[model samples]
Target: MSTHRIRFLAALAGLLLLGAGGNAAAQSTITCESRNGQYQSCSANTSGGVTLSRQLSSQGCWQGDTWGYDRNRVWVTRGCRAEFRVGGASSSNNTGAKVAGALVLGAIVAAAVANNKHNDHDDRYDNDYDNGYGGGYGNGREIRCESTSGRYTTCGYVDRHQHVEIRRQLSNQQCVYGRNWGVDGRQLWVDDGCRAVFVVY
Candidate 1:
């Protein structure tokens, strides 16, 4: 080949290599850990950046740092857990294992917290339920209903709302309500009169 033609081919090859390197650099894996470092979870192979949130309810409680990943700070509650998300690239290498580890770690942490609370006789932390309804309430609108008599009360749902649902009961009195709660697309009803906080997902 002529010298000019050879130079052109070499430049093309270099460009291709550079492109490949760029792709590789853009790839990244996502991992999650409880604030206390008692639990760690990682996502499948992914590129770019990952967004993580704490598992909602009993799975674990975590709050993400307001800042970006560089300043990532996860505030874990007594029963804290973590979640990971892969971004950019799509690969599931060893993801199942990572996820399983995360779940196991979460269970361990939750159990530890429960045991501690039980020993301490902490009524405030007791009776908390995690319905496995997913992450925080998100941007959904909040609807609240209060009952003073601890009697069954209903918090009717509004229209145009859909998805997962969760309820929180707050009471100043040390009363326990039976598990006679029910939820529909439009409303949530509690059989007892406890201040109910409902979030429609």
Candidate 2:
């Protein structure tokens, strides 16, 4: 099985345990919290069973929405902060659906990857956001991306996971990587009066 499939199965195992409600007075609990809107995991005996006992954040603690568990730990994301009750009986014989579910998920992931690759070329746009050099990154056309007056501005579309390298610098303001300019989400951003022509592969 692929790594993604294995991870999906392990997380599913924890969701199943939540449904198998056992002891209400389970003597164990642990607090899991998401720090600054980032996902966080906390150690707990989640195999026993898990339930959200109390919420510490204004973000609602909805099961499988803001919080989830695996066999070993409970995770919180999207500013969720909560104490989870653990220590109910671990459910066995629930492996029947795990493999089937993973197969379906693997297919979905593969299809998404294929679709993204097919349309990636057309996704980049040449907007008036920067002086026109052209929007073609791999088509041998260069786009002029610049930050004006030390203000941050988006230049062009570049995938958050895609690598962008400076093909040529147009500014004397030092187009240093990650400081004066960088890719943020699906757009390239420039800051601190940095200007450059970027290429993405």
Candidate 3:
């Protein structure tokens, strides 16, 4: 074969390998549903980052992101039907449907690996949640606690309507409320008083 022809063939092979790798790195997604076709709250796991989309605007949906999982909750204040897409990848070059499709792909790969190691634990968990077992991590709430003198501050995940109490006295300071609730539904502040309790829904 001619030198130029051989060089062309080698370049083509490299390009093919690169394209295959790119496809394998693409994201995956999964659709999540509530139990009994009705649920006050629910959650699901994912391989990568997660973003939520509602089937209908009437069905209000809320989500929280954590390591290796995405927690989703729905309220009846609007509607009852919704779904979640998991394993989304963050990319600066893509937008809209392309990004979503990649996420779905990633989720599928992750689920397969997890199933092999744990005997389909992921499937069982989803089944239990769908069947009304109330399976999930946090209660879809965030809590932040601070000391009276503003010397100490702590924040963590809390369940819905979960009561959080912090007791710490700096001198003779009483608990002073800074902000009852955060605009994003996940904040608690205390100043002056040594102890405070916050109920997050």
Q: What TM value does model 2 have?
A: 0.34
lDDT of 1 by residue, 1-201 (tens): 344654554555455444444533343333344443232333344334555543533443322211123223222322344454444542345344445555544555555556563566533212222332222335554557666566766776543224323456565543222233444334555554556566655
Worst 10 residues of 1 by lDDT: 62-71
User: Where does model 3 exceed 4 Å of error?
Assistant: 1-24, 35-45, 54-57, 64-80, 88-196, 199-201
Q: Candidate 2 vs candidate 3: which has greater TM-score? A: 2
- Candidate 3: global Cα-lDDT? 0.40
Evaluated with lDDT, which candidate comes out highest? 2
- Could you give candidate 2's per-residue lDDT for residues 1-201 as a string of tens digits? 456765665566555444443423355878888888666888877656788898999976666545778888788776889988888554354444444555555665675566564655434444411334344445544457988888889977754334567889999888865456755556777888998997764
For residue 45, what is the lDDT in candidate 3? 42
* Candidate 3 C-alpha lDDT tens digits along 1-201: 344654554555455444444533354444444334332334444444455554433433444211113234222211334454554343434344344545545554555555564563446544544554333433422334545445544444443333344333333555433222111233343433344444343
Once fitted onto the true fold, the runs of candidate 1 whose alpha carbons sit more than 4 angstroms away are 1-137, 158-168, 173-180
True-structure Cα RMSD, model 2: 12.9
lDDT of 2: 0.67
Best by TM-score: 2
**Which of the two, 1 or 3, has more lDDT?**
1
How do the candidates rank by lDDT, highest first? 2, 1, 3
